[model samples]
Target: MRGAILPADSDQAVLAGRLDLGEGPTPVLIRGGMVEDVSAAAPTVSDLLERDDPAAVRGRPLFAAAELADRGPLLAPVDLQAIKACGVTFAVSAIERVIEEAARGDMDAAAAVRGRLEARVGAGIRSVVPGTPEAASLKAALVEDGMWSQYLEVAIGPDAEVFTKTAVLASVGWGAEIGVRSDSGWNNPEPEIVLVTNSKGRIAGAALGNDVNLRDFEGRSALLLGKAKDNNASCAIGPFIRLFDDGFTMDDVRAAELDLVIEGPEGYRLDGHSSMVQISRDPEELVRQARSEHHYPDGFALFLGTLFAPVQDRDEPGRGFTHKVGDVVTISTPKLGTLVNRVTTSDRAPAWTFGIGALMRNLAERGLLDIGGGAGDGHD
Candidate 1:
């Protein structure tokens, strides 16, 4: 059975319904098109999954998906403490990274990046069990590199990096400015499958997400990826969660198809599609890695990486890159509904100041600086 988590028509309260998809699986209850307020009987989406057993919470009331008032959907699926993003999980991504870096006229750096990608690809085939020959060889090579590394990817935490609103606002107060871009300031939008987990880091459901990134920031320093990605309104997820039970497995999820499309005022800017099977690592592996060092007490959401993102070949001179204001991007799947957002630029841009005091004052003038280092400073 399929459904949607929605905001109540009368008030702004969030709600869910078991959709009437006609002749598929039988839902818990059938009250017209959806099971309105699935939370009435089951509080959270996690609770709904926990009680999904036929013998457990059978005979509950159900409703329809069409009963609600017409309102654009919210992008965020559930309350989350952090949003983690995995990168280079696809071969296409590796190719794109190397090419883009080369375009910046850094052949040596690009070659080193390529070597690391090769190492990662090879390592994935080797067993990393300690004491094994492969493990020892891999460890020695890493040590010999003497701090050299690549953009294997990262998971950006801190609530400030996540956004649900349709428009992405870059702020001047927190160092987000228009003129601060490195290359053309042209940013690209990536469509990916998002996994929603509970406090214990257990997978509960799936959803759509866009991991917005600034190419210019990444082009400058590979180490500055966190800065390139973990900014305000950089991460987006939702439309709603698609739940799964103990019976569901990663293979089952991987079998599903995910697609993305970006449209501007002129027409379609970018389009692509891919499956989880193309990813280098499993979603479970990524989630486990993300939680290895940090604690997400309020639970977390993860962007399982992306596939088939548009790449700028050296031959193609004028490939349109970067998203602009008024651009609309969507990621959709039959299992999880489409997540759409409009691109909007912030009114302010970053400026060069002599000291931290001036920088603080600039933030204060825009009512962006947080007092006592609280929410005022959304720094990661």
Candidate 2:
């Protein structure tokens, strides 16, 4: 006997199965100041997160868009122990990084490093094996057993003490704004499609992330990445989480489109779009690398990297443009909606002002190379 097929009117059923709605819950939103499950279920997003099987609540009814408030403030969708990010996983981003690294004070040294970076990233694009010449060369650039590198800067390390800005910036229905430091040498919102993993590194769902960074700090010296990435109020993610399920296929993900739109304080707009095909690595690969030596008992967030960049004109090089305070950046995609944030400068005191001058003077008095430039000695 042949099996019966779901009728054409079963598109809702298809969505339910695809998003794991029929069992646990549809994507939940804190709409109209009330917790509402986008799925037809009564379990709130918080309730679903606490369940052993969050998707079990999907059998509940779907929420009507009309009944909920048209718009309101949105949360980060889920609470994760750590927010991690991958780098050099896109062709355009790889090239942009090489170019920026090449411009780091010395043109000749930067040129040599740029060639090596290009060759490494190119080989990685072709294959992921460890023993290959490209793999070995790339591995050598990074220390700590290739877990960290010049390109792969960890925005949020496994340390829980560093979590910041878990809530997303809300702007009605269009998008959101992110804060950028005005004094930062280079700042840009990298549009990334992120993966949400469980405590054990299992894929749970996907969300959109804006991996905001200070490119100049990163370029100036590879050792200063912490200063470049771990600035206060520098990271954000939101819109909603799309739970992984049998129906949510890779084809569905690759077919979706993503755009990174920016608006400066003067209202000048720049359009940037990313191609999923340009994604160099998959979520599994990113997760494996992120969990290399550390244990994420509370799970973690992983940014899959960016594939789009601003267009370059004659006056500007490939990525000479940088985001300044008051600029707004939005990551828009059909699956994840629009995640937005505005750039703003931090008001904290300078990092070098905490008795550092006296310490430097003390070291100089001891004849320890006068590293602090006292009396214009400039000796090390």
Candidate 3:
């Protein structure tokens, strides 16, 4: 139930519980490239948006998705090798807050705090150009609903959500679909990257950060600078939420296969269906740990303190600002019914870690991290 707005740097994405679209789900993917302002009728997902957010819609088209089919940008899934060589800007700070705080309970309160933090982070960044209408509106919206946050899912196949895990890693601002789990290891023919695989079935995360950065950057901060969202069109996410449930639960990773096809000027770029990387921690754990680390505040004063921390970096702290662009996103999962989030980033030396302990412990003391544990576990 707990999840952040892809660009955790945008608005606050409170992790709710597991929301099963009843018996079936009508899931469609809209990539960053396809993120166009297309106004499509709502799909059958019933409720995609939040009940409170009247601007919410059951289903709508994405502007990024629109750009992908029509835009031109080098978007690809990266491994730990690539991430290391490139560096990951996806700082698990703000989203981590949402996770930890909500885990304590107070979903509504968590939202308010995270929302303010995201806005603060967005506004703090120096606009490349400075002052233009788009830039100005973007700056204002950064505190409101700027360009850093936006998405829309469409229902593609009838059995769209069949056995998929939609891992929308805001770090990458995209998602992947993990189909099934594998018993053996995958000899990766692909480039260097972090392959999220399942061990037994507990779902642990295996990160192979690149040992060196090939760019002209120094440390994490320099690397983070590379993560800036430039001509980067859009990022896309999966057909459905990859879950380790029944029928689809073959335990063996080979039983699952989620695919994504990218046709650029170079012909067709095929990914997935090939278990090059193994995601140790499945999506569930990703969300679980993400939230587990967030230490909320206690009373009103403490909450206020956490909110106005800097009103600047106080919200997301370290690298969270980069999340506004999210890192490189992907669609498609592996065999184990989970989504593998392929993201990009800068070096790892920067102090991007958000002080969840400092915040959450305070919040937990007051009774956050509850939320009934995300509305989690779908019915039988």
Per-model TM-score, in order, reads 0.60, 0.63, 0.24
Which is the leading candidate under TM-score? 2
- The candidates, ranked best first by TM-score, are 2, 1, 3
How many residue pairs clash per model? 11, 29, 92
Give the per-residue Cα lDDT of candidate 1 at 86.
70
TM-score for predicted model 3 compared with the true structure: 0.24
lDDT of each: 0.49, 0.51, 0.23
lDDT of 2 by residue, 1-380 (tens): 01111212222222111122333213453222223444333222322343454555534244543322233333345432366777766656755565556667232344455556566555553343323455555555544444344443321222111222222211111233344455675667778776766555566666777777676766777666666665545666665556555655555555557787777788768788877765655556667787767766545667777787543321234334677667777777765556666666644312322132553353245443323322113211
- List RMSD in Å for every model shown: 11.7, 15.9, 23.7
Off by over 4 Å in 1: 1-32, 38-63, 67-69, 102-149, 152-184, 246-248, 312-320, 346-380
- How many pairs of residues collide in model 1? 11
Better-scoring candidate (lDDT), 2 or 3: 2
lDDT of 1: 0.49
lDDT of 3 by residue, 208-239 (tens): 11111111111112222222211021122221
